[model samples]
Target: MLSYALLVHAAPYSEQGALSALRFAQAAVAQGHRVSSVFFYRDGVHNASTLMAPPQDEVHLAEGWRALAQEHGTELLVCIAASLRRGLMNAEEGVRHGREAHNLEPPFVLTGLGQLVDAMQANDRVITFAP
Candidate 1:
């Protein structure tokens, strides 16, 4: 089975790219393929914000990704630079930046771009859902 690294480049609700990545991942896993990592870059980093409280009627995109990670061990990697720029951050980052809270949580890791490179290197295929 081929391993895949997925790249998401848009906000979760602002465009279809994020959901597309999720559905594609589900399909891939069901087909017996591996999703090594889902890299959220640019506006896509918003997908990792634990603070997102969408309407009850809407699907919680972040939770969907989290559940996928929990079940399959797929890494949910968010670009630190992109996340910080958009006011999304982890616990350590919040403290470093002198903030009282953070949105980046477990299962959703705030990492540097090198991790994306590493994911690209480690996987057999890369599928990008861009804005």
Candidate 2:
């Protein structure tokens, strides 16, 4: 099984990057390949926000990503700088920023850029899906 790392750099609904990454990860798992991690950067940090409420007719890409990670046990790491700038903070970050609460969910970690570097080191393929 090939170990893959998916890098997403687009916002949740504005483009197909998140969906494509999700589908690719799912297909990889179905084909017996291992998805090492999903690294969210730039506007992709929105994918980890629990506060997202897309229109009823629109696809909830954030939830879709969350489900994929939960089902496949994939590590979802959002760039800490990106997420903080976008106000998509985790519990600890929220406290540090003097916010009331955080919106990030489980399996989606607010991490440093080092995580992506680590993924690149460990994964055989590091594919980037940008807007």
Candidate 3:
């Protein structure tokens, strides 16, 4: 089975790119392929925001991605530069910035572009979902 890595460049709420990536990953896993990681960059960093509170009737892409990670062990990574520019921060960043809260949580890690390069190098396929 081919191992895949996904790069998402769209926000969870505003575009279909993120959703497409999620479905692609799910389908790949169902077909017995391995999805090694999903790297969220550009506006895709919004998917890692814990403050997202979509309507009950809507499909929460963040939660869906989180569930995918929990069940399939896919590494979900958010771009550090993009996340900071958009005001998304993990606990360590929050503490460093003297903020009281952080929207980034478990199952979603903030990392550098080097991680993306690694994903590209390590996986058999590197797919990008962009808006």
RMSD of each: 0.7, 1.2, 0.7
Candidates sorted on TM-score, descending: 3, 1, 2
| Candidate 1 CA-lDDT value | 0.93
How well is each residue in 1-131 modelled by candidate 2, as lDDT tens digits? 89999999988878988888887888999999988799999999988888889889987887777777878778999999998888898888888889998999677999999999999999999999998
- What's the TM-score of each model vs. the native? 0.97, 0.93, 0.98
Tens digit of per-residue lDDT, candidate 1, span 68-100:
899989999999999899999999999999999
Q: Arrange candidates by lDDT, descending.
A: 3, 1, 2
Q: Any runs in candidate 2 off by more than 4 Å, and if so which?
A: none
TM-score attained by model 1: 0.97
> Candidate 3's residue-wise lDDT over 1-131, tens digit each?
99999999988879999889998999999999999999999999999999899999988888988988999899999999999999999999999999999999989999999999999999999999998
Cα displacement (angstroms), candidate 2, residue 39, comes to 0.3
Higher-ranked by lDDT: 1 or 3: 3
- Candidate 3's clash total is 0
With a 3 Å backbone cut-off (N, CA, C), the pairs that clash in candidate 3 are: none
Clashing pairs for predicted structure model 1, backbone only: none
Query: Candidate 2 clash total?
Result: 0
- Candidate 1 segments exceeding 4 Å error: none
Task: Evaluate model 2: give its TM-score.
Answer: 0.93
